[model samples]
Target: MMNSREIIAKRVAKFFKAGDLVNLGIGMPTIVANYLPAEAKVMLHSENGFIGLGPTPAEGEEEKDVVNAGAAPVTIVPGGACFDSAMSFALIRGGHLAATVLGALEVDEKGNLANWMVPGKMVPGMGGAMDLVAGARKVIIAMEHTTKEGNPKILKSCSLPLTAANEVDYIVTELGVMEITPEGIALRELASGVTLEEIQAKTEANLIIPDKIDIME
Candidate 1:
């Protein structure tokens, strides 16, 4: 069986198509780069000023100067370009990204996202998340189903401060893939070995289950 993070990343990678200029946010979202289908010609973007970002560098092959927005060493594909922060944010805010995958602390049925910081916790100020969510053509959230304390992250409404209001397009968790539809949060697929009742019990949001639910590969 795939691990929780791998399962989430694998499903999230399926969302991208050829020619996509995608951005992977700091944590779990970055893992999606390693899982992209070999045939899918996607260009990964790093907010720290690199486009055509490649998968995580292999052990012992790390380059000191080449890194992702998270400061982790990463590879750059052929034709990748590097520029300064001004140009990077310009691309983000100018709506050049095809999609952005980000990890969220909480997401509501209305597509509200809250990922930057928790109350009173010391955190680096919200980086490009605010701009990426608002500017990307599509915003996909890659997060665990619940917090470490086992509390649901998908809620009826976010209790944490908002990162972006109603900006999330799709949410992929270990349990399944959900889409923020006009009707509500729609449960589009279920992971292997997961049941509908278990998902419902764990999620605070009332998921709109379709008559036919597809199982995630």
Candidate 2:
């Protein structure tokens, strides 16, 4: 059985094309940087002001000054440039990013994303998430199927503050891959050991399953 992290990584890697300028958010989204094909020309963008990102480095290779949004030490690729956080945001806001992979708290059927803050829960600031979702050409969310207590994270509507309303394009979970559309979520793939009925039972959002389901595993 594939663990949640591996499942999310595999799904996220499928969306990339060569030469894409991608922004990887704090958590699971950062794993995709390590899994992409070596020959693929995907340039990573760090919201803190760096381009030409690379995978997490070895223990001895860690650079204290180089980090992803998650604050994890990461290796910088050749020709990488670091600048001010403000300028980095300008790049995102200017639509310089091709895509951004973000982690979400909840995702609606209409592709609305809520990842900023959990209402009533003490947490850090929302950070640069708002800019990433708004400026990227495509927004992909990486998360698990349910919360720690076994409740769904994908829902008909979000319970937390929204990062972007109707802006998400794709969602990848341990259970499957869903494409967001104007009508609702389109079921694109189901993981091994998962059935459409089971997925529907576990999900809170309205799902549009195809006549034939694609097994994502």
Candidate 3:
């Protein structure tokens, strides 16, 4: 069985298609880079100003100032280009991205995203998520099933500050892949060994399991 991070990354990778201009958010969502299918060619855009991102740099060989939005060193593929933050955001706000993968703290049934801050917590501010969620052609969230304290991240409503409203197109977690629909959170696919009952037990919101199950192997 795949580990949690690997499970989430692999599942998220399934959404990528040919000719996609994608942006991967910081933290766990960044791993999606390593799992993208070889047949599906994608151009990775970093809000920090680089496009056509490659793999993360090896340890002890880190180069200065070559990084993703998280400031971690990353390799640049051929044809990659860098621009000022203004131009980078222009590309984002202009709706040129085919899909953007983000890591969220909470995503409600209404598809609202709350990923920027946690009230008293010292978060680094709401970076470019507000723009990405609102302008990307498709917004996909990659996150863990629950918080460290076991609180479900998927809910009927978000309690924390919101980054965008009704913007999530897909959600990939360790347990499954979900579609945020008007009716509710739809369990479009489940992990090989995960069950609807198990997902229901852990989820706080109403889950819509389709009549047909697409069990991911």
Better of 2 and 3 by lDDT: 3
- Model 1 lDDT tens row, 21-97: 99988878878878998789999888889888887789999999998777888899998999999999888888899
* Overall lDDT per candidate, in order of appearance: 0.90, 0.86, 0.87
- Regions of candidate 3 where Cα sits further than 4 Å from its true position: 58-62
**Model 2 lDDT tens row, 122-196:** 567778888888889999999988889989888998878888888899989988999998889999999988888
Choose the strongest candidate by lDDT: 1
Runs with alpha carbons beyond 4 Å of true place in candidate 2:
none
RMSD of 2: 1.6
Clashes of each: 0, 0, 0
In model 1, what is the error at residue 22, expressed in angstroms?
0.4
Using Cα atoms with residue i matched to residue i, what is each candidate's TM-score against the true structure?
Answer: 0.94, 0.93, 0.94
